[model samples]
Target: MQNLQGKSIAILATNGFEQSELEVPRDKLRGAGATVHVISLEPGRIKGWDKDDWGNPVDVDRTLDSVSADDYDAIVLPGGQINPDLLRVEQKALDFISKFWSDNKTVAAICHAPWLLVETGIAKGRKMTSYPSVKTDVINAGAHWQDSPVVTDQGLVTSRNPGDLDAFCEKIAEEIKEGRHERRAA
Candidate 1:
């Protein structure tokens, strides 16, 4: 695995996040020697959404109201239909995500999580991919939507679905190692 020792990663998610999407990357990053923290909108734990039912609960390490983008080297946004749908409407979440982009920190998203990217207004003129159902939404947000398993543009990394987790996690670690990236203006 890529060595990410000394790096700190923040995963932003809420209730309803896809179980695998959140857990896999968290485990992968931690295994790579990076410190990983799950930040949510509240204290305590957030429940995940499995295929047809609710999944396990993950403890929140920090709340949105108590943390800033400057606290971590990178951020990961995990997708579940309901997770992104709910987060997209949250101004605090959007602001926190926007700060990462503005600061040029690595921001990775997978599956439906790209919806947060859309709401942050950072999708314009970037190449990204998400769950098939989100293709049109991404395109409509001015992003160049593709059908790849994983796509990376600047410091932004995105993937289509849970099946793409391996590639997605790899790209995320690669991008984090590369460090901050200034995105080209649209």
Candidate 2:
């Protein structure tokens, strides 16, 4: 595991996030020595969406109203069809995501989570991958979408689905270790 002792990471999600997508990466990042916090739209806990049903609940460590992108070293967006769809409409969420890019902090998304990336307007000109269903949206956002388990462009890391968690987590840690990237202009 990479040494991320002094690093801090934020897992951004809301109700309906894919259970595995959020839990797995959160565990892996914490195990790797980074301080991981779950930031949500509300206080208390948010429920997750499992394979075909509602999954477990994860406690929210902070609310968007109380925190900014400057609070962490990196941010992770976990995908579930409903989660990203809901998040993409919020200007606050989009602005928070934009701050990560503007600051060059690592921003990692997996599965349908890249939908939020498209809404943030940072997908343009970057190489990324997401659940097959999101390929067209990503391309439309000007990203070079690829069919792969995982793809990393600068500090932005993306993966296709839950099966890609291992590679996704690894790339996120690697990118965080390397620190901020000088993103190319959109």
The deviation in Å at residue 86 for candidate 2 is 0.7
For candidate 2, give the lDDT of residue 118: 94
Q: Which candidate has the top score in lDDT?
A: 1
Error of 2 at 79 (Å): 0.1
TM-score of each: 0.98, 0.98
- What's the count of clashing pairs in each model shown? 0, 0
Error of 2 at 22 (Å): 0.3
Give all candidate RMSDs, comma-separated: 0.7, 0.7
Could you tell me how far off, in angstroms, the CA of residue 75 lies in candidate 2 after the best superposition?
0.5
- Once fitted onto the true fold, the runs of candidate 1 whose alpha carbons sit more than 4 angstroms away are none
